[model samples]
Target: MNPAQTTSQQPRQDSPHKRADARRNHERVFAAALEVFEEFGLQGTVPQVAERADVGKATVYRSYPTKEDLVEAVVRHRLAELDRSTAPVLAEAEPARAFETYVILLFENLARDRLLSEALAEGRSSRNTGPLLDRLAALMDQAKTAGRVRPDACPLDLRVVLCGMCLQLINFAERDPALWRRYGELTLQALRP
Candidate 1:
């Protein structure tokens, strides 16, 4: 092959503009999926998500071929956002405050986004939560040591309580929005030593 032909045969890198467009498309797809899933739960279809995103069905399928794939992707995305929001608090020196802040953030996220609440409520297993659970366990241990948390209050108990409260809010928020704040306050009170 000629020298010029050799250069042409090499794979081309995506231009900056193309990369930006891809990023935007990704964001749009993710946002649309969240909305669709929120409105329809796991029964939401890919075509519906694609329509909501204003992109071709092929575009959505290119990233996630099945509804399950889309749901998993959306869950992973939400989990990442949760992790980012809680990371700073988890790093703080005060374990009780950190744990409280983390729980509050979780409650707030669940209240604000029905999609995330649904995703979490589905009880799908994802490996990403292991580290988060470990961190929470460490924080609980610290709080127990500091006399902020009760000796019998384990990390799993905290998770179960907070998650149950959030699920209740999601289930009842349509009838009464006040339930979210009320349950949140009650949760905090119950968690305290």
Candidate 2:
């Protein structure tokens, strides 16, 4: 083969080591963001995350591009996880148990993910309850049919009740886990038929 022809090549994709390094950096950046957000709320600076991650500020910006983008990405990632965990609860045949379990899982999610709790506390989650309402409505209908919930329990009402429960738990998470646990059951009881 001609030497010049043999030398021709396609551009390289990221190598395995490069990809692994990128993954590690990504995780570090996210971890840093989580810590910063937990400490300073959503207003936490990107530089803070970079410092915490021990990465350059430009690296953080390259990963997230914008503050809102970073916040949105983290929130969505957490919510997606919450959704996956609740999917099984929603699929359960028993309505009351399903609803109760769903709330419990949601409370757990809020308790674990500080950034998510802060976002909820900031009222950013209010605008995105459509899927939540749909799921709750369907579950409530099943529970009603199963004679588990009250007769007048609509999905929207259930959504409001769940939102209230979540907010209450979030407000009380720092002060008292027991309080949230108590109210969690109470809220579930109220939804029971």
Candidate 3:
């Protein structure tokens, strides 16, 4: 190869590395955001996440411009995870058990995840809730057909009950992690046929 051509055509090796570094930074910021929000709910701050991730605030802002944007992203990611976890519960042989298990799982996750709990309780960013709702509704219907739940049980009814439970549990669940499960059992009992 000609010397000048070789020099002029030298690949920008740093470009790929820069892209990979950017992706790693994004993943770090996302994981940090998840941890911060899980602990602090929506009250968590980008600066706190940046500190946790050991990245600059500008780095987080580069990928997520605002707090709301960051929250929406986190919520979407969490919802996807929650949805994935439903598969096993949905596959249970007994309809009532499936419904009850799903409810308990939701309560456990909410009790442990302040941001998701708060977001759901406050009814913000509801678009991503559709799939979970559909799955829950399906389970509820199966339970109803199996003569497990009370006649009036509906998906909205569960949401209302869940929101109320979250409100009651949010303040104390951290102190007593099992409290949400207790409430989940009570909620299940109340729904019995």
RMSD to truth, every model: 4.5, 4.5, 2.9
| Ten contiguous residues minimizing lDDT sum, candidate 3 | 122-131
**Largest lDDT belongs to which candidate?**
3
TM-score list, all predictions: 0.73, 0.70, 0.85
lDDT per residue for candidate 1 within 1-193, as digits (tens), equals 7899767755354466677887888789889998887676666889899999999998887777777888877767778888887787677747657766666666666666676765554333346445555666676687778787788897667767766776666666442435555665677678777
Q: Tell me the lDDT of model 2 at 1.
A: 75
Regions of model 2 farther than 4 Å from truth:
1-23, 38-43, 84-96, 120-130, 168-175
lDDT per residue for candidate 3 within 1-193, as digits (tens), equals: 8998777766576678889999999999999999999989988999999999999999999999999999989988998888788776667647767888888888788777888878777532267656666676788788888888888898777767766677767655452557778888887787787
Model 2: per-residue Cα lDDT over 32-132, one tens digit each: 88778755656688989899999998888878899877777777676777788877667773655676677666556665566675665443235343455
lDDT of 3 at 35: 98
- Report the Cα lDDT for candidate 1: 0.71
TM-score of 2: 0.70
Candidate 1 regions exceeding 4 Å error are: 1-27, 38-43, 89-93, 122-125, 173-181
Clashes of 1: 0
* Preferred candidate (lDDT higher): 2 or 3: 3
lDDT of 3: 0.81
